[model samples]
Target: MRPKQLNFPLNPDYGTGATIRRVSLRAQSHRVDAHLLDNFHEMRCSIVHDCSIVTAITGESVRIPTTACPAAVHQLQSLVGLPISTPIRDFYAGGIARHHCTHLLDLAVMAIGHAPRPSTEILYEAEVPDELELPVPMTIWRNGRLVCRWLVRQGAILEPLELRGRPLGTGFAAWASLVFEQDQLEAATILARTWLIAIGRRYRPSQAAGRPARDNPEMLGRCYAYSTGPVETAVMTGEKEAHLHRLQREA
Candidate 1:
């Protein structure tokens, strides 16, 4: 089936925070004439347009809607210095990829106990290595309120090296809220882990059916690499839950 077009417009006023005005889709001429599936089902098989944009906005710095494809979502991952999944080849081309990816991250984070915080007073923080630079602007939010911002300063020193023997650029600055109670932190951690696991299961070449044999190597590599790091750390550390829950009750 030919792909469709989905458009999501971001509010021009960055001051009121980023807002999604609407999401609309259009089918290809050939596909328009063909019988179509429901929106939910069609999304599963179709190429979603601009899917990476949503993932890019939500994964690291922003907590927005989570609905994007795994590969496109991975491409949105600023930490990984890979190209965005090729539009034509990726499952869910267009916005569908992004929407699926966002949902995966959101689901994973929620699974860990990182519920949305109620206040914007908390400080959001993340630690990054001095390499594998972030190309996009980093946004900081507290209880859903935008607070501060930073961009990955290029020319920074590289410390960590990938398996490829290439020096990792400066690591990415993660987005979280400063006003989050301890429970919220725990929840967020859990949610992030869950999201990763979900993405890994759904998109990993080893798990997905119908993928070509030649495609296996790269997909496997990407899945393995994307699943590592902070999310893993969050999963390993069970301490955050109790502490966060207590903090939430007190709040």
Candidate 2:
């Protein structure tokens, strides 16, 4: 068997969540796919396509038939006028109608989340270092075109160094999660820790209320650096579970 694809989950520690999901879409296409697998529950499906559900067929544990309440999560048609990049905040503001289709909303969000990540130049520029000598950009590639890059200090405190040219996007962890269908429902236990290290905790350690990430190494070799990691990395795992459950309930 092939190695399991890496996906970051939003919550773990329960039979409800612990799933691995993947999302795929063609460029500039309306069609999208979401595939979800609950590893701990030993429930899995693949190569099953529902035009209604391009990715994984979700809510197996929830076990409500799609036909039972068609209106509950069928608001996707109203989303046509909206841009694919519509932020989740804006989507939430749209309000859920009693007949609104929650699965469609979830899948649509997953579709938009797969958006392309920004180049290293973009992330570097976003940091906007203080007056300094001309900075250089270093490029590394994987599989011929995948430039391998990461953020690290130049052996100094809070100093950001230049690295890769391609990343999924701002809040990439979230977007990548949607794109990859690795939300907390999939692979919860491992993904929780995986995200902690890969997303933020590994880079921005010891974050506290209001203190933020003041201990990370900076490009200046003196001051603390701005953190690019996701907020999920800072909070305890239980916090994420609570947050996700609230969102699910609201949906």
Candidate 3:
């Protein structure tokens, strides 16, 4: 499917030999609009918050892997009455993530978290290399400035001795939180989320098109598409799940 046009400009060189993800956030006095684009998904979220509470929220899945994924956009309404005062990382811990699209929820929290900040807008770019085994750099950028870059291999940081051997998967944000604050904290969060999605680049979408999440043992009870009971049978395509299953069965 063709990607939707974004309101902001992107770095033309950002996509070279890498999977690039961009999150554009713009804010008014009481509303924040967020748009996300990457190789496998494109989504948008708008959060209307008063000084300290979210009064309204909406989300749209512009491009996604599965038909069921779009329904997660509606789950964003659940955040309508949530407090904006909650920390961005803590928002997901409140038990709202299990029934929502991870990316959409991420956008929602970002929009709400930054609503009170003085900046009118922010742009974040993350580039994860196609080849992780080589010494190529993985990077995260904020606005137009480079935030962090590292040589990564097998999900561990190889360069940047301070972060060497650090796992990029689970517990990354927690470790980053302890080491960063304010602007650094925000950058680390975006980088962590981007790394999660960038792995989708390893698989093509056609391998599992129109498959139900319930059929995949790895996906049961994971996210909105995989929610149990009535929704478990929803046609939810999963790229990583497809790849893993293929490797297991084909091997």
**Among these predicted structures, which one has the highest lDDT?**
3
lDDT of each residue in 1-251, candidate 3, tens digit only: 11122112233333335677788899888999999887677889999887888999989998776667887888888778878888766776755677888889989988987888875888887777765336657777777678888887766788889988877776776677787786777777677666666655554444565666455555555578767753555754543321110011111
Model 1, span 123-218: residue lDDT tens: 222111121224323333333433323232332222212212211121111232342344444333322222222211112122223322222222
User: For model 2, how big is the CA root-mean-square deviation?
Assistant: 17.3
Q: Clashing pairs in model 3? A: none
What would the TM-scores of all predictions be? 0.22, 0.28, 0.81
98 Cα displacement, candidate 1 (Å): 19
Tell me the TM-score of model 1: 0.22
Q: Cα lDDT of all candidates, in order? A: 0.24, 0.27, 0.70
When 2 and 3 are scored with lDDT, the better candidate is: 3
Candidate 2 structure quality by residue, lDDT tens digits, 58-152: 32222221122222222345554455455555554523422333333444454444433221110000111111233322222211232222232
Cα misplacement distance, residue 13 of candidate 3 (Å) = 19
- Model 2 regions lying over 4 Å from their true place: 1-31, 35-67, 97-99, 115-251
Tell me the deviation in Å of residue 233 in model 1. Answer: 31
The lowest-lDDT stretch of 10 consecutive residues in candidate 1 is: 237-246
